[model samples]
Target: MILKRFFQRSQSPARSCYEAIVAAARHPRLYADWGVPDTLDGRFDMITLHTYLVLERLKGEEPEFRQAVVDEFFRDMDRSLREMGVGDLSVGKKVRKMAESFYGRIAAYDAALAAPGDGLAAALARNVFPDEEGGPDIAGVRRLAEFVLTQRARLAAQPVRAIAGGDVRFEEPGP
Candidate 1:
């Protein structure tokens, strides 16, 4: 239900892009941590507007806006990454990796939806559009979000241990 709620709040074109960026940043396994900026005003506003345009096109309402929004989104992402002190090489690599992974997942989900089944395929399909019949399934999305969040939480809660050779050394627990 939490994922459903999160997505519900995220479905607003005005907010979904920001939420997506936040979600990506929060992913525990991410390789970099640029830390939060002092303010999210301009960047957030740009992302929201760009995302809204993308959503409008996806919904077949304003198809012409997609390319412009996409261009603006990349420009904003690059600027934000630089402002956060992410090195040029690192930013480019990370962004490309993220984009590839994101697009791959989306494509896979779309393919799954085109198939005829009601199991994992159905679940994957649901992720692409979590609000329509045979489309997005809130319950499924919630399950996935919870699973990812739990993994992230576990990673965060883990104590840092030193590994030497083949062995790990951990600090003693407090009495």
Candidate 2:
């Protein structure tokens, strides 16, 4: 079993892409300079956003590959919940809810991206900073929106072959 796990870990491009997504999401500037709350939900939102960007870029790729990447995401989420000491009985339910949240974010973000003006920023503010009183920090959310737009274009310009080979690259988020 250990050897099998090792082999899969070493061979999976999906794994590499998932890792890249997590690394990008964990960039400290996102939480510190960009005003994303340094909390579990905030982190999840960031990861979801990055995942959407990659998936969007992968739209015309093999269906199996896309599904594999998504499977990797859910597996990681399951592991995260387990590590957080969530009871086994509750983990599935929580993951289901998370999946719902992810899909919802994807839909919102996708539509907002095509919307005119501050639509994307508004969506990010609503989803990423949901806990903020009155409203999420508009300026911070706008900054994040700009980052997302830039990354989306960058991802689009990247060769699909490289991304399919798990060579995804994301620019550092900065102030």
Candidate 3:
């Protein structure tokens, strides 16, 4: 049973998609040029944002495929918490909180993207930049918002077959 599960995980398309999402979220330019914080919360927000974009694009593709990807994301979060020395008993609670945060972010981004004007940028500022001494970096927040919109369009252009085949690409972020 254990080996079967391991092999399935290794071979899953969902795994590949999750990896691509993580790679995109971890792009150095996001932190350096776009001004996303390099801290744990910042990284989490980035990953969550990227995941939302992919999952949004995956709509109507296949319910199972989306569920698999979501499962992989939660599994990674659980693993990360464990590695960070979170107690096993506490892991579930933290993962739950993470889920709540993820869903809230998804809702925020969805609403913002669907709205006109500076909604998206405002959401990005609130979530990506969070609290700052004077205020969040407006230029950086705008840049990041632009990057997110561009990625959304790029993902939309990708063939569903290609995405289902575990092949996905994200354009590099720039200064």
RMSD (Å) of each candidate, 1 decimal = 19.3, 2.6, 3.1
Which window of 10 residues has the lowest lDDT sum in candidate 3?
2-11
Poorly placed runs, candidate 3 (over 4 Å) = 1-10
Q: How many backbone clashes does every candidate have?
A: 2, 0, 0
User: lDDT of each structure?
Assistant: 0.40, 0.91, 0.90
Indicate the residue-level lDDT of 60 in model 3: 80
lDDT of 2 by residue, 23-106 (tens): 999999999998899999999999999999999888878677778888999999999999999999999999999999999999
lDDT for each residue of candidate 1 in 1-175, tens digit (9 for 90 to 100) = 7677766632333233344434433333221221112134323422332243233224443343344335445665677789989998899886686456445554544444356554333443333333445544445444433433343344334332211011111121111
Candidate 1: which pairs clash?
129-136, 130-136
TM-score of each: 0.35, 0.93, 0.93
Instruction: Quote the lDDT for 139 in model 2.
Output: 83
